[model samples]
Target chain A: MACDARGKTTTIKILTGLLRPSEGQAYIWGVDVEKEPEHAMSRVGAVVETPELYPELTPLEILTYVGRLREMSPDAIRDRSKVVLDEVKMSEWADKRTGKFSKGMKQRVGIAQALLNQPDLLILDEPTGGLDPRGMAEVRDVIKGLGRSGITVFMSSHLLYEVQETCDSVALINKGKLLMYDDLARISLWRKGGRVEVEALPPIPPEIVERVQAAPGVKSVRGPDGNRIVVELEGGDEERAALLRQLLGWGLRVRSFKDVEMPLESLYLELVKESR
Target chain B: MATEGATQPTVPQAPQPTVPQADRRTARGARFLIVARFELMRQLRRRRLLILLIITAIFLVLLIVVIQVFRTASADSYSYASSFGGFVPTLAALAATFFGADALVGEFEHRTGYLLFPQPVTRTSIFLGKLVAGFSLTAVTLAVYYGVVATATAIVTRGLPIEIAYSFLLAVLYSTAALGVAFVLSSTLKGTTSASVMTFAVLFLMLAIVTAIFSVADLRPDGNLAFAGGTISNILSGPYPQAYPGDTEFPGGPGPGGRFRVYSPAVPLSILVMAIWAAVGFGLAWALYRRKEMKG
Candidate 1:
């Protein structure tokens, strides 16, 4: 469940034109970030690491400045800044200088500034980093709302739980190398077929273990320890049911039954170690 | 997925209704004034800018009082006021250095570039806008400083000369040249303190070196910004210092051939010198800012 948050940050920066990729191309909206960053990065909104802002500027001023920089007219900047501040729940303090604000408040203003132009791709690099639980939750909720509005949200978090809790599709990288990329639901499904572990009253004979492997849909069998056996099956629930029946009929004295997980941790360790 | 229609942004809810989009043509264009407007505001809001203004104002008042108290035989000369206009560029340059030295560096050191650079605006626009903003504030300070000098001179001579306006224009150009130099430093350094301090060093310390080199070689100092700035105020005092003899009034002067011939920057040449400094300084600063990547 470890995450290479820094690697993800590097990718975002490259895409946003803040950093250049030395060996390969990085593109945003089909425009090469290096050659056409002005075109590509224009549609992106990013909050990298912490929310850094001018301490002297009020939240209203910062957002208005960003809106103006994006070439929004005075009327649009005025209207949009109000909306952005309200979205970040800082409407009341909109006129107050951010110097006096807390980290959470500063972060809110940062998020508000990013939304001033209504960007197409919103990249949040550890948006909740270094926040109290409440602060983290507050930012998390804000990000969730952004995603619902159909903005393509790209967020990086070192916490597996946070990624699982926040992202749609997950990309896991370590040491600048991509480890996995897939639907969030299927990270635990690195390989096909379910693994089932069975505990028996006594060790099944080696012959019985072999017979179980020979059963329909059973791809492999391991362990014939004094008490249990492990089965890797190539079929769905129906095939699993048939294998359990075959094992029971063999009188292997089955005492317990359950599905086991793929060794993702081991797989990750091996992948990282090998890449190293 | 956990993010599917989840997490509420703390916004007040109104009834959901279909709405048309607003035009974004302006938002997609490159304009420095957008940045300049806020940058001007940002410059004005800082406490250091105010402190510099107050101190310069105090210096002008002291100069006036010194003339009033001494009652020299040429009390009606307003000579002090004329010479003081010459120092306006130095003061204005100092003020520019204070604000502009950290102009671009603040964006990165304060981490504001993380927000600022990602916007659709080009870096060229940002650099140009910030220079305009920095120069604008410096101009305001120069105006206030000029006001004191003019009032002081009018009180002594009972009338102000046309040279006051001419000098004011020159001072504004000199101030811009200062900002351009500071911008060069700001864009090259990574930290606010380093950039600001180095700008002061360049304006003062490095200036001494350039002057020394010109003197040791007995060369005309037309290329020096400080020398050009002196000519801006020198015009207000009297005719531009004449050939070879130069301004005996200017230190290390009377030129190489004594009174036989001296070299001082002529009025038009003085302006051209400042213009050249302005051009080169802004050009180099913009180039550095444009190429800089945000590795930090």
Candidate 2:
């Protein structure tokens, strides 16, 4: 969806009917992109990277113009344009020239343009690239709302956290090769087992490292401090209990046991490294 | 189990709602129009475009003023009529060429093509729409200039011959041809500067270089009509011509000075040439635009 080139985010164009895969086919709503491009693309609304707004036209005029091209009645164009502008929180600036808009505002306008037809499939590349925190939240909420409305959103972003927060599923690519493709939650689960940090009552003995390493389902053991022992295990309730039992069998006192959620950033790094 | 079986057997029913395909098509068409209209309006609002129009208007006014000044100073109606009427088409062609040459290339330079190409509209529609807008703008300016000049001339002298009206129409046609050629160049060249420079250079070469070459060759001894015809032929083939219709006469024996020899591109030939250039230029532009990757 997106990649960093010299520290700038570059999004690959993924228009519905335009691009054809070398080995496979892309489709939109069961229409094959290659064979039935017009039909395939009919249901899609997309903005590649930057807003392609005409700087000379007001946002309202722009929406109406594109609406006319779609053969919509004048009233429908106006109604939809207003609705979309409001949805993106750009109603106040709709009358202003797009050339004068801020980058964030332009991105919002781009989103509104993409949503104009109420597309069944919306492909946005870095839809929130230039947004502030609140703007990003608004965009994410809008996307979430679209998903609820049964619009399949396929978006690309370099921000792992944003993708993690926003996407229902993702296909990660590196060097033009697919690295991973699955639900975000499931991919995170697959990357590495969740970590458990324990504060030993009697302090973890350096000599008991071998015993902890030999514990059932305990993949690795390490200590950053004298009182704390971090254990990596294969995830599952049974595996967790077996590791705890082994630790108790070793006569080690446990002061606390807490599971740490694996951050998507860390998982991404691990996956990238593994692929290499 | 017997009690459950005895109870009315319940079956899950699928939702029987239907959304006609026509409704979906209407939605998609609406989206395409939004993008197309936005593109048209954005281009119409550029500062450079406004400035170009203003400059053209000022030039037209200056031409009128110059003609009036000459008439007042010398009390010569012939000079004023000849100077102003002769130069209109050439001036219009130059103005149209200057603006139209960069129409498509400017989009590439600004990286705005990336934004429009992804929508549902075909590349042909985008190219044609932009071309239509550019032509409309040029035509409007030319019309205003024509009206202004005609009004000024009427005020300066009693009235001009009907031939001037014919010349003005020819000028508009010539200007449109120049625009088509420039649009073609814009599509061919990726850089704005290169496209602009090359388009103007070609125009000049077609008009000046070919004429100069024919003069040096001494192709015609008794009459320059042969050379003029050759130059017109060359202009038709080449990308640029210095002297558009009514600009100046071709070099050789008989020039614009000859009362017996008239030097206008045949009306049908002019129309045909312009149509050919527009079709070819726009055809090439459309092809390149379709294949162009909006990577920026």
Candidate 3:
């Protein structure tokens, strides 16, 4: 998220039939959400934007009610509700009224309610929006578990780290415009870094920076390290070898020269910067 | 109904037993009943119901105290019961306004529909469930009120009149009518508070407008809900009141007499009017509810 995440939530609400789209259409399982919302939404489960539970109801009660609406058998509803409550780690508070629960606890119950019908698609809009660090970790673990259970999870977040940690793929949006969307690994690899850090056995002199900057195929140079120099190469495999040879010819000992960087953060920043 | 037992759902004994939904119509009916059952239990658990119970009890007690203070509480129980008979429909209207008004709007206002609308049920199912829930609770709340009146009347008179049964039926019918009106307002409105206030105003204040309109028109207020309410209370007035031209000037004036004809509809006509309100209001509300998006 470059800024806000309203677009992610609005899209979820529209697909869940809680809101109507002014233009175009959305579908689930080949059924149109606008024209056949009952059919479409039945196949999808969503928890949108700080969903509030009935304060008078317990988690078991709310889940059972939702299951009953889905026409689950009474025993099935009971067992399913218990299973969902356990999945969200609220088995002990299953019987307690949610009126007195923390925001995180309410969010858990909301997630459990969404899981009652066990739909093919589970859409959660900021499932852990305002939780404390510990609360966020708990919810994130549950989400990650759900992600691995063969159920499709579509989660939106403004916290880049949270998305990086919990999501297999990421969609970054800015001001309703999708800036980038790809597998995290693939996106990270697209921008191969060209800078190499040289940890020299014998530290290079401060005046040697100008000579290294003047070396062929070396675009830039920085750092008078304990015994190292960083060289930004213009391109290719030969540039680093030539730069290392030149450094050694100057009576400098290089211990290790390595290209070490993942480009996801750089890519994200570049995209966001370009978009802005 | 025997479904009162079914409504109290527990864990099923069978393991994932499949109930075949052979048709959308049949499926809708089953879903309607399930949601209605859920909503009924929901209302029973609401704290506001308890408050309504308290308010009704205090009103009844004060009524009895007022009658006793007038030294007529000791009168023959049949007449005494009829003296306080009007409270039934009044309570029905009041209860419908208090509880039923917010039933549908709160589902959206409180964002409860976020959980409800994504289910396999249709909007009509949601509306019907809520209507049934409000009707069930209103009936129960009215039951307690009538219970006190009935038990006291029976104890003193040593007998129960068949006409009081008719009166009770009218009260329940009237309650259903009021619920229909409340639901119609709830489905179309945005907020619970506004829906409730407008529903209450439409329930009682409509009577004021009706009275004034008919008074100015020099016509009888036969089609009014309040008129049916009068017929409800009149069923226990020893005999069913007849419809006839009343002692009036047949012209415009706000005074009681010599103003305009007041229509005390015969039992059948009154029942017809109340039924129309119930059917049409309930139908229109369902229609509107189906189109009402959960924008919240």
- How large is the C-alpha RMSD of every model relative to the true structure? 6.7, 8.8, 9.3
Provide TM-scores for the models.
0.81, 0.76, 0.77
State the weakest 10-residue window (summed lDDT) of model 2 chain B: B1-10
> What is residue A249's positional error in candidate 1, in angstroms?
7.6
User: How would you class the docking of model 1?
Assistant: acceptable
Fnat per predicted structure, each in turn: 0.46, 0.24, 0.43
Report how closely model 2 matches the true complex, as a DockQ value.
Answer: 0.24
Candidate 1 DockQ, CA atoms: 0.30
Error of 2 at A230 (Å): 4.1
Span of 10 residues, lowest total lDDT, candidate 1 chain B = B1-10
lDDT of 1 at A141: 87
- The candidate maximizing TM-score is 1
Candidates, ranked, TM-score: 1, 3, 2
**Alpha-carbon deviation at A54 in model 3, angstroms:** 1.6
Candidate 2 regions exceeding 4 Å error are A1-12, A16-25, A32-38, A192-202, A216-220, A230-245, A248-276, B1-44, B47-53, B68-82, B85-90, B97-99, B153-159, B191-201, B204-207, B214-271
Candidates sorted on lDDT, descending: 1, 3, 2
Higher-scoring candidate on DockQ, 2 or 3: 3
